[model samples]
Target: MRLDQMSGAKLEQDGSSWQAYAEQPLTFQFSFGDLQTNQDKIAVFVRSVENGQPEAWVQASDGEYQLTLAQPGHYTFEFKARDQAFNYSPVTAVDVTAIPVPAMISVPLLGEVEVRIFQLLVLFGSLAIFGFGYVSFEIVQHRRRIVAAVERGYNPYISGEPVRRVDMFFGRHDLLRRIVSTLHNNSIMIHGERRIGKTTLLYQLANALQEVEDEEFWFVSVYIDLEGTTEEEFFHLLMDEIAQTVRELPELAPEQIEILNGLLNLHLAENQYTDREFNRDLRQIIHILEEYGAVQHRGCQVRLILLMDEMDTLSRFNHLIQQQLRRIFMRDFAATLGAVVAGIEISKEWERVESPWFNLFNEIAMAPFSTDEAIQLLTEPVRGYYMFEPDALDFIVEHSDGRPYRLQQYALEAVNQMLHHKRRVITLADVLVAHELIQLSGQQPKGSWGEDAARGELGVPQTPAPAT
Candidate 1:
């Protein structure tokens, strides 16, 4: 007979989902459906998909079976029948889902858990709030101090922007002194690396000459920045300035003013002169100024000191512009047309690609400050404020290595740190902190922090960042 005809197991009861407060048990029943032979055993096997195999299997015949699952989930029960001849009925599987016990539970004594959790949250939240407030208060106080410093004529250390006032400028007395004496003798060249205060010195020189213009007027200083101008623009602008200068100086003789007027009239007028015509007129105007620029300002004749700043900016143009400048500087402009030319690397042998007439200029190479000069620089402008610690001053001077711009940057940042920490006197520690902060913020591409510190880059530390 077929196995189905011999015997079979059945899932006749206990297969459904139910909610229970007490233990819920599952039961199964088997059937020997018209079997011709006797059956030895009947069994049930249970397995779960999510929860894996159930605890037990069973063997019985024509009897009820029960299973208690370990957890609430869906399960499958396989019911089978076996005969004494080792024949078995086919497995009949039925799925059942057990309903979980109600979610509500009660504990008689949780013992102040809610109160303790509230207390912990309050304590941490208070700390976080206090930390934020303290930092904010510190920042506000810092800003107020800086504002007060500014209000009281606190001269800040400036980088890149040249100091226009003589009172604000520092550490260039001797350089100015030499240039003062040299202006009457020959053409002047003020050259240094970028951001080295070349422009500021030129400004101060003009101020010096004007200040003494009453007693022994040597030259009326004329400053022109030739950055971002085309060759044609430079020539026209040069001539335009010459005309304006002649008109402004009442001390120049009528003949002297007329000479400049005749040559530069082509430019000041709407006359459409080509680049070559402008150059030709420029040469003539400058040649006349070379003869007559020496004027009676205070009994003695004064040369018009032509201060050309950022002259290297012109070298990127065509050779015609460069040649015009060379002729003007090398020949004559304003009698002893004193030329105080300032540009980056104009003194270096390698950067002389523009012209050989650089040799005509006596080099007044811009340099960093000495220790005494550096101290004066730090203290002189903002004298009445809190005294600087000698060690702090020494540290700044040493680290900055006398670079004017770097020195100012270091001092200003250190002062800022003093304000941040509510410090009365700037200390060496504050200096170090300021140095680190500024170094971390530096954006220069070509140099590293270590290299800058060694070379005296402004506001960079002589040491390293600290480890947490």
Candidate 2:
């Protein structure tokens, strides 16, 4: 008997069993050299003593052999080689064993129930269709409904339309570092010009916080436009979001959910809620989140991150709301959670409120993109959409001053105009034409127009560039 081209074989001394690590097919090479002279047959089978089970015997050719393990266990492989003359060799025993790993033994009853109710139902329903051979037909019908609903209800901003993030030359690393480190310190303020991508940065930061994964930290990102929102509406929106998130999470307990909902509603209903309601709610949310950090053996340390965008429009409470928020932010919940509040010149505007919390917040301003960053943003689009001349991007970047909002706006408009005109290349002339058309329509102001005045006329905030 000879073994040829043997690979991936594991051997251990002082043990009857040999081990190989695999969950799939197992193959090996074995040959009888003189078998060419006579007809022969060989049988291979794996017998398990612990289970007292034997696999179906497999026939082997003279040159090579293959076998597969259907289950994991300790087994002895037997080989019987017989020649055409009815000669047989003694049974050759090869021991095989599969290794196992430790797993969590306890399952919480509530979680088990949820899994059975949601996951098992969906899985078993799909399995039944598959078993009946109607899987493809059912999938087609279900997929059509999904596609139709998505087409009907699609809204870019609400749906989180994909925005290709461009790595700016003066990266946001320093600002991000300060914001993350401030998780230990308290709240931080993001005050900048309009369209400077404050909301974008906030979303990006939320993504970054996923790295922390420590249970102690919970990140709840809330974007309240404050447009057409009353104090009741705002409170309800916040509460609804928090409640739904808690309910959806499988890891949290029903008691914790009840505690959180009770605390939030208590503060809201008692009219004990003042401007300090935001502060008080924030404190409670953080406290509840901290409880998620503690397990029996290990305490997961995490930060509760609150990212709020468009702080200026939260004026439903009259001018008094702003003043109350400023005071509450300055005093009440300064030591608890990390917050990023975004608005245009908010710190300056809030200073009149005389709230020291306004003073305590670590203020960072976002500057407009540098010329290079603007050019990169412009050029990066060319590979995806080829309506523009290579030189057109440079021209757009020059005119836009590396402002992301304006860059995208101008680029999108320019491409539309070029396609409308049936032109092959978008030139500087095309951008100039679009500019004239946009200016003529009073969509954008002409030369020397005041940014704030233009923003007010357009009903859009002027976002500043991101600060390095």
Candidate 3:
């Protein structure tokens, strides 16, 4: 029997044999032409052309045979018809060729172009995820390092208050020297805008005078904060500060202490102490010191320096009270008692030619720190432990405008940032972060008097209020 019909793959007659070809794995149905008696049973077999080994014949069902080719190859299919008596006809062969379709060309939902695009997307997506994870991990590690550094005391900058420690005090050397030299003969008025380190300078001056080894004069430096004092209580407060300071003098004899206490008790009243009483009490104290200096150290004259801070309060007093204060310094006490008074401005009243305070003091305007001084202030305290990058240092100096208080504030915040990141080096980025923090805390750096003066926001200059 010969094949009569075939389906699924294109079949063509090549000479006497039938041929078929398929792009994918080949499968087809075929039927043989035979008489009814011969067609009672049919069988089919398959074999590879390369191997030439035939498979056992299997009976076809219902006069039709189905064939499947799973691999790409040349194959032959043989069909036969068998009678009930068991006689079989000659084999009818068909040659078939199966060619595989490339996997990329036939992929579901992804053609050749789509498949390549998908592969690229996956590659780039994986890389982006890895990069993001790495950056996030580094940020976390940096934060941990900063926290650890801060706990270990990496920060050493001071802000918001006067520097009480002498070790942490920096710069102002020339200013200090000038003030000391001026105090030998004349009183000084240190005038500056707020937060310009007026009080800090006062503290330093106190320490410096206490350590003086002068041959001609013995210095008795008394610091008095004249904030919130009424005019009537001024003399009482002055005497009270003088008594406290003298009591702490290491060179004072027991009898000298007793003499001072006696004078204080006699002239410092519980209420209504007068300027006369203050003058009398100061005169006796100086005399006592002079006597002690003469006997103990051979003829050194004693001088008392009143380091009066927040002297702007004096401006609020009536002109009579102001004149009374000026007269005290202008009269008999001028030689033995000198004053280094720090204030915002010496009230416009003192600027008058006829005013008692006019020409009384050698005024020294307390300007902002010089660039060199600011550098010393910023770096000296944290020197050996942490450092600032050059750009960061410049940023602070430029932004702070050499104002000591602003410099400290900026440095303090920068250290805080360094501590947070556990970095030993302060960068410009760190200072910028510190600046934002300061502004967030409502302490924006307003620069110093020059800027303020330009804006007309600078009223008469004033010392910073005392730290609460």
Top of the candidates by lDDT: 3
lDDT of each: 0.61, 0.54, 0.71
lDDT at 428 for candidate 2? Answer: 75
- Model 1 residue 328 distance off true place after TM-score fit, in angstroms: 2.9
Question: Which is the winner by TM-score between candidate 1 and candidate 2?
Answer: 1
lDDT by residue for model 2 over 171-213, one digit each (tens)?
3546666676666556777878776667777766665665444
**Candidate 2 deviant stretches above 4 angstroms:** 1-178, 213-221, 227-250, 260-284, 295-298, 313-333, 351-353, 382-390, 421-425, 444-468
Error of 3 at 426 (Å): 1.0
Using TM-score as the measure, which candidate wins? 3
Tens digits of per-residue lDDT, candidate 3, 1-468, equal 656666655555667555554453334455554466644454444334534767776666664566555555667777666666666777777776555533353445654544566677779999999999999998887665444444553444445567656666777778888889878889888888888888988998998887788788878899999999988788888888987887776688778878886775455454668777777787778777777778765767788899999998887877787777778777778778899998987745567897768888888888877888888888876654568899998998998887887787788778767766767888999899888877787774332323222322222112322121
User: For each candidate, how many residue pairs have backbone atoms clashing (under 3 Å)?
Assistant: 5, 15, 6
- C-alpha RMSD in Å of predicted model 1 compared with the true structure: 25.7
Better of 2 and 3 by lDDT: 3
Model 1, which residues run further than 4 Å from truth? Answer: 1-155, 213-217, 246-299, 332-334, 349-358, 443-468
Poorest stretch of ten by lDDT in candidate 2: 153-162
